[model samples]
Target: MSLIPLARLLPRRRSLGRSAAALAIAAVFTALFTAPAQAADGRISGLGGKCVDVAGASNANGTPVQLYDCNGSNAQRWSLPGDGTVRALGKCLDIVDRGTADGSLVQLWDCAGTPNQQWVVSGANDIVNPQANKCLDVRDRSTANGTRLQIWTCSGQSNQKWSAPGSGGGDPQPGGFVVSESQFNQMFPGRNSFYTYSGLTAALSAYPGFANTGSDTVKKQEAAAFLANVSHETGGLVHVVEQNTANYPHYCDWSQPYGCPAGQAAYYGRGPIQLSWNFNYKAAGDALGIDLLGNPWQVEQNAAIAWKTGLWYWNTQNGPGTMTPHNAMVNQAGFGQTIRSINGSLECDGKNPAQVQSRVTKYQQFTQILGVAPGGNLYC
Candidate 1:
């Protein structure tokens, strides 16, 4: 949901008769009370566009509520259930002592439906506690994780403005097939701590093919297929760089003009799909405008870039197969075609059924989690 600045929403009054004033006031009240509520799921974007999160993804009462880099975990999902309470992990967001004072710490506690836990969304996007008449404030206006949350007099400052279901967060649904941070985490719980939700969101926003190329079902399946291959490629994204160090120098293709600008050894496989080969890096860099050809380490250093590289391969390259993974999915070519597109020479032709099965299993699990049916042609 978008936030409107309070200053812009203020009413400008001109000289008017009492009857006219009363009619205007009534109209304002009607508009205020009748505004539609935004959906309850998604990120709660706050200061610095960071998300309000449950520290450590904990469900325990008293867990600190703080702003953190959005990682798309269950810890960041929030709901403003109509009972006037804001909730996460099925717990109420509460103040330390129902304190009306500024700087009172906010924490998660069992929902008691008290006035202290009740909050209302104001026109300026401040989450206001009716009892205290104060807004949920980010202490010290810090953007760092673990920064304390507090209650302060409504100021309409950026620190106090918030957008719900979070800005740039949520599931790939009917319109766009972008994966929600929650869905990504579910598919790869063991993903490297660096593979964050914000990063993946940025990656998807950067590349249109993954989510924009197909039908909603195809979009979901495409995401599943890509991540499944990514899982197999990097062992559930556990390894940031290729495990076999010997392959490092081998990735530099001397045939390319801008060959291995980061150094011959720098083009080794890195990121979710284990991007390798100097030519691949050059192409991905050209498409992403990030100069991966000159500094492939950017993939390892930046999570969003890493994911972008994976999507680049999935959408553009066919390798030994006849079609790109993007086309294979959008055209209903089956999951086996995607595996072949990614690594047909190594895993297809009955050369490695076990490896093929590994990819298929991950895809199946992901499709089930996404509540989609995995289509046919399970094997290459």
Candidate 2:
């Protein structure tokens, strides 16, 4: 958590320094009974977020697997590559003695690649064996540690649920946008067509480390903060390009060597963060491998590029503040710091409390929609 800083990582900008800050601070999935190979390894958590562990860190065949605290031990680590095998400590998860009926015990054993060793993820995080048509579940529906595993009728209960690895710990849709499209609609009911949801999602590929970091709470908060600022800047995702025509020519800086190749007025406020200025366009362009200097209008025309430009600033630029907005939220520096990072020179420290409060209000409302308590430092 100490590395809390940055806006863009893996186009997700998560402060994991990689997570979804950049939740979009998002990272990690695949699907079907086993999900994706990308989702197979690490730890399979079940029953109160505990990891599936090899008992006593054993490697011998027939060792039992149980729910234990996530200790990152080799015993707790597992890989399910959708090859029909769940492996750990050089062994496969198997049913005792190849028993097929209910109450068949489960344990770690040498790889057989048989039906007894194969498992699948199905129905809302359930780990099942298609051969058994039964779920890999907790024995006796117990939440206690060291509880054994067994096959049981699928009742769609919590204990029967299993979170595959690479699921962002507990998030169901890993690497997917953290904000539901419905929630997004709710947040920006009047959003401009230029600022499409698909655009933002597409843009996430650039900052792969953005939201793929930290605990679940930090990930969501970073995502919310980023969206809120974008909302405020774009006027509820309304305007695609800056409105003031008079300010257009002023964005170009004559002193820079590159000297506004796109024309003096091309580098104007545009996109989600309302990216402006020739130097800014050059910086973000250089970072993104796009030629904003020659085509500043691309920010207004391309939705993904526009969103990417905004993310590039968020995950990188400190603006007038000391830390990037991504870092502020990841570090629990309070929403106030994000404002400082974004436009604190103009809005914080009593410069424009109204503007600051406007952003804060949107942040509060957005966090409410996301169902997370807005952490402290709500204002600058």
State which candidate has the highest lDDT. Answer: 2
lDDT for each candidate structure = 0.71, 0.71
lDDT of 2 by residue, 1-380 (tens): 12111221112111111122322211111121222122334878777667788899999888888877777789888776557677788889999988766789899899987878876553246666645545788888676889888876454445666767642222222446667667877898666656655456546656755655677677778888999988777678877777667777877778888788889888778888888877788888888877788888878876667888888988888877888888888889988988888877677899888888888999889888988888998888
Each candidate's TM vs. the true structure? 0.58, 0.56
Clashing pairs in 1: 43-165, 43-166
Task: List candidate 2 segments past 4 Å from native.
Answer: 1-175
Clashes of 1: 2
Q: What is the C-alpha RMSD of each candidate to the true structure, in Å?
A: 21.4, 15.8
Error of 2 at 108 (Å): 40
Error of 2 at 149 (Å): 46
